[model samples]
Target: MARMPSFLKPPKKIAKRQLELRAQLWPDLNEGDLWSRHTHDGFSTIPSTMALIMSIMDDLSKNKPVSSTYLELWNRSFDEGFATLAKAREIAFHSGFSSERAERTWKDRLKILHNLEFINLQSGASGPASYALILNPYKVIQKHHERKTRGMREDKYNALVARAIELGDISLRPADPSPPPTPMAPPAAPFTFPLPAGSAVPPSPAAVPSAPVPPTGVPTSESSKV
Candidate 1:
């Protein structure tokens, strides 16, 4: 049997020891209002390393930290991997943008996040940012690091990688390339009406008989000679 690589193995003992220490230091920690996804009615699961991810996102943006905005989206998202951002004003307010330009500021942050590939947007009845499909942040960060994206903080990326390795997270790996689009079948030949069985072909315009013309000086049915 092949031996598993040490680097790939999770630190079980260390994690257990940390948990024991936490229990000792805060015995009533579990009794507090700490929310758990399993027990909570309204909660969304997010990565444990979200703080680091947010910092990385901030670095990539090269502007104000957009962590609050991202968090708001996450909070609104369900397990379905998408979020309805119909209440743009509410999201903006919650994301700490309470000024007259709050919504605009939120939109700018959304654009930054979109450019970084963290979330995909689609316009809907609500507005331009009506719907947001959250991407795997780990994969996004990994790709950015691989591509050497400008403004990506190496230290934060390295920490994220180490944490992912410790947690045996597969999301850090690249996804399989999507299959090429199927070619569209040629537009069906213009529909033609099938001739009915035993039906004769219709005569051409020239073959059809036309009304006879009266001679230029001759009286017709409407005119009588006296």
Candidate 2:
């Protein structure tokens, strides 16, 4: 095993950075659960598998958003084949894992993920089969709905609409809330005649002006004070 090149030295304060990154990446998914299941306490498989998936997920997040109005995605695929397996093996080996364990993890762990429907699988004719799932379409729907409910941007909203249409069967429209009953105007008070043209509203009797009355006693019989 040749020594790692000195020029490729680890960064200063990398431990804190690594911890911060890990916290950001796996922030108490559900108290104890991380986003990925294989990352549980009993991780006997090659650690590289989880690392690879996490890296893929990060890449997917950066690239293929549910709907990208601002970005042109640099889409990448995790194909199932010799090259991918070899890469996993290499990561595991570099992480102080035995080659046999790396190979076993490459086979066994990914099968678990596939069985759980975490990855989409496609059969290949005379070629290596492939599997993928960066962001689950259902999860994407949930996330987009949350965004819309919380007020997403117009461009993003339009992109999501386009993507929803592209997806065909997946409905992005919220359930019609049976619109607020059209607010019937209380039958318009059942008027028999049309209102008069100007100031048709009659003043209340109390609001009408009254004539001024003479003083109670002093002007009762005032015939010009004769």
Please report the candidate that would top TM-score against the real structure. 1
lDDT of 2 by residue, 1-226 (tens): 6665655445658857976888899876465443433233322222222332333333333232212110011022222212122244544344334665654544343443344333444444412323334334334434534655333345544564565566463545656778677766665566567677785687767876787888756655656678
TM-score of each: 0.65, 0.23
TM-score of 1: 0.65
> In model 2, how large is the Cα lDDT of residue 96?
38
The C-alpha stretches of model 2 lying farther than 4 A from their native spots are: 1-98, 125-129, 133-226
Which candidate wins on lDDT?
Answer: 1
lDDT of 1 by residue, 1-226 (tens): 6665677455889869987998999987865567644344776678989999998988888877788999999999888888898889999999999999999999999988888899999999987888999999998888888899988888898899889889788777557999999999988888888999999998867776789998799888777854
lDDT of predicted model 1: 0.86
Q: How far is each candidate from the true structure, as Cα RMSD in Å?
A: 12.9, 22.9
